[model samples]
Target: MTPPVIETRALAIGHGRQPLGRDIAFSLAAGEVLCLLGPNGSGKTTFFRTLLGLLPVLAGEVRVCGEAVAGWSRAAFARQVGYVPQAHAGVFPFTVAEVVLMGRLARIGRFSAPSRQDRDIAADCLDMLGILPLHDRVYTAISGGERQLVLIARALAQQPALLVMDEPTASLDFGNQIRVLDHIGRLRGQGMAVLMSTHQPEHALRVADRIALFNAGQVIADGPPAAMITPARLASLYGVSESAVSASLSPLLSPERNVLP
Candidate 1:
């Protein structure tokens, strides 16, 4: 049997001396897209960092590609797991192509220069994301949407089996949101296991194969989007009445029975 790309068993994640979320048992297999849906400060970021090995797991285990994450070195782990962070201001003056090429550094020794194939892969990633024209632009000079695309391209250049994205469409306009979601869907079709966090229930409906509903630091529900995102479940997760949820969701999700004239 092919092992999952990432698996957490009885996992507890948070800062040292403080556990934020517990019993977060889940497995993400290749060609899967699992969306973590939660409100702000609900420990979604904490869980994400822990899975990326940036923070310590307070208990339980996280295995990536059949081996314990704790046993893998930074470079070894990065080779198989890539991360796409929320778009942020860049302090450095690195060009877009340069930033994408940085992903290959996991395989390239720190002291070594990027090889021809490394450059090719970077270019390919940019092309794949339809952002090859931004190759020479200063990373900080791009708009938020473009910056997010660049970050996705950078993670793709890593050629990882599993990708973790944090709010990939957070600040984008409506069209950009669809574009980002489309890219995510494309990646899933290409057999990459994706674990991403988002606040938008609609985004989960559009892209997630599975939804993990988070509330008060733990996963309240985990299942296919169709099964997990009922009006009652959403209302419970967000502490609202089911009628309010149905009303808000009806326009984009179904008939307008919940809404009134």
Candidate 2:
């Protein structure tokens, strides 16, 4: 069998002298979208940091693209994994295209400017995300939804095998949330492995090929969205009354042809 693009074996994710959650064991195959669902402070962010190699692994191991992450250089890792943070403070006045082109810095090498090919790739990424029209606009002047799209395009410009997004639609309106999730679903269809953390189970059920529910520093459930996101499971995971959980999911459980995977 082909090895997964990302694998964590008994992985312990944490920050300075503090372990976030339990040891995690999971693998993400190419073309799969794995959604990490948990409430705030449930170690979701810590887990993402660990996966991106931003946080130290207190125990276990994390392997990316069939090699230990620690064994690979930072540049090599960046080339393979594209990460989009939850929020970005845009202090500079760079154009959207310029921000997106920064994704190619790892490939461009230090002290070297981007070449024609790099610009072409950046443009292609913007086009792929349907944001090419905004390439010339100032990033800080765009709407929040547009900024999110720019960030996603930037990640895509890296041409990574895996895309990791913390909260792709944290504070967006309903329409923007659907737009972002739809774009991510398309990325998975294009053979990119995607892992996103979300507070909404309905979002996961709609787009994720697999779902991993995190609680108290460990994954309590990991499986297909249909199997793992039932009312009973959600109630247990959220520590809520079972009836309340069922009531809240009525809309999701209703018949809908466009239901999430």
Candidate 3:
């Protein structure tokens, strides 16, 4: 059987001498979307950075494609893992196509220019995100939501086996949020593994094959959405009352009345 695209065993993360999360464990396989749900400041971003080897692990190990992540060179890792971080403006006013084309850097030679094939892949990625028209727009001039989509397109251009996205829908409007989630589902069907952090439980229910609840610096629960997204679980994770959770979720997710009256 093929090994998981990413795996963590007894992992610990932190900054310098401080610790954020420990004993972290999970594995994401090909064709799966694993959603991380947590409150703000819950260390989800820290965990992602550790997995990508941006920060040193305090303990344990992170493995990608059956090899230790710490052992892989930066270029080798980029060839395997694509990252979509929170959207922000670039220092320079690069065109959207130029920004997406940067993803091809890992595959290109040190001194060579981007090839026709690379440009084609970047354009295809932009088209995939329904943002082909933004190709000529200035990255710094677009709206935040548009920038977010452009970042996703850039990551897709990498054509990596695994994608690690931090709050992919953060700046998106509702329609675009759904579009991104639906595209995530499609990516799974195409045999890519995705590890994304989101604050929206409803989004996880829609797209994730498994949900991991991060709270107080640990994975409090990891399971199927049906089993993990109950009123009690969400309430505890967010420090809200269970009754409130039920009241808010029932009208949307309840079997009898999924539509609001």
Candidate 4:
């Protein structure tokens, strides 16, 4: 069997003397998209942080691209894993291209300028997200959707083997959400592994090759979307009525609506 791109063995994630969830064991293969579904404050962020080595693993192991994450050098890990955090307050007025170019910092030495090739990669990423025209616009001045695309582009510029995103499309319009998710789907097709956390099950059912339902601090269910997204599993995860989950997600399973809102 081919080794997985990412693997977590009995991982226990938490913060400040509190364990948010149970032990987790899973592996994500190349060209796969794994969507994490959970209610707010269900330790999704903690899990993401743990995977990125931002938070210490209380127990167990995390391996990325066949090496223990804790054992890898910071620069080497950064090149292998690209992370896109939730929207943040931007104080700098840098242009969109400038913001995206920052992802290349690890590849370039301090105080060294970006080469033409670096600029080209950034521009290509912008074009991939259909935001090439916004390259010259100030990052702070652009709309939320545009900012989201720029952040994604920045992550792509890292040329990572795995992309991890926290709520990549939490506050976007319907059209923009589809656009962003579609772009993510394309990346998986091109052989990049993606793991993203989202509250919207409909979105997960549409774009995710696999779904992992997290509750209380651990993944209660993990499988292909068709197996894990049933009404029974979703209801238990969200503590909602089964009928409601069925009703809200039925449309998502339709072929016509799978790619759009």
- Highest lDDT scorer: 3
TM-score of 2: 0.93
Name the regions of candidate 3 deviating beyond 4 angstroms: 259-261
State every prediction's TM-score relative to the real structure.
0.94, 0.93, 0.96, 0.93
Model 4 agreement with the true structure over 176-242: per-residue lDDT tens digits: 7888899888889889999999988778877899999987788888899889888898898888999
How much lDDT does each candidate structure score? 0.89, 0.87, 0.91, 0.88
The most accurate candidate by TM-score is: 3
Q: 195, model 1: CA deviation in Å?
A: 0.4
Clashes of 1: 0
Candidate 2 stretches greater than 4 Å from native: 256-261
User: Between 1 and 2, whose lDDT is larger?
Assistant: 1
Tell me the lDDT of model 2 at 52.
88
lDDT of 1 by residue, 1-261 (tens): 999999989999878788888888889999999999987789888888999999988999999988898878899998999999887778899999999999999989789999999999999989877789999999999988888888888898899999999998887888778877888898899999999999888888888999999877788889998898889998988888999998888876665442211
Look at candidate 3 and tell me the lDDT of residue 33: 96
Query: lDDT per residue, candidate 2, 28-51, as tens digits?
Result: 999999999887788888888988
Please list all clashing residue pairs in model 3, or write none if there are none: none
- 8 Cα displacement, candidate 2 (Å): 1.0
Q: Write the per-residue lDDT of candidate 3 for residues 1-261, one digit (tens) a residue.
A: 899999999999998879898999899999999999999999988989999999899999999999888878888999999999977778898999999998888899568899999999999999988999999999999999999999999889888999999999989998899889989999999999999999888888888999999986799999998888899999999999999999888866876876321
Q: Which residues of candidate 4, in runs, are more than 4 Å off?
A: 254-261
Deviation (Å) of 55 in candidate 1: 0.6
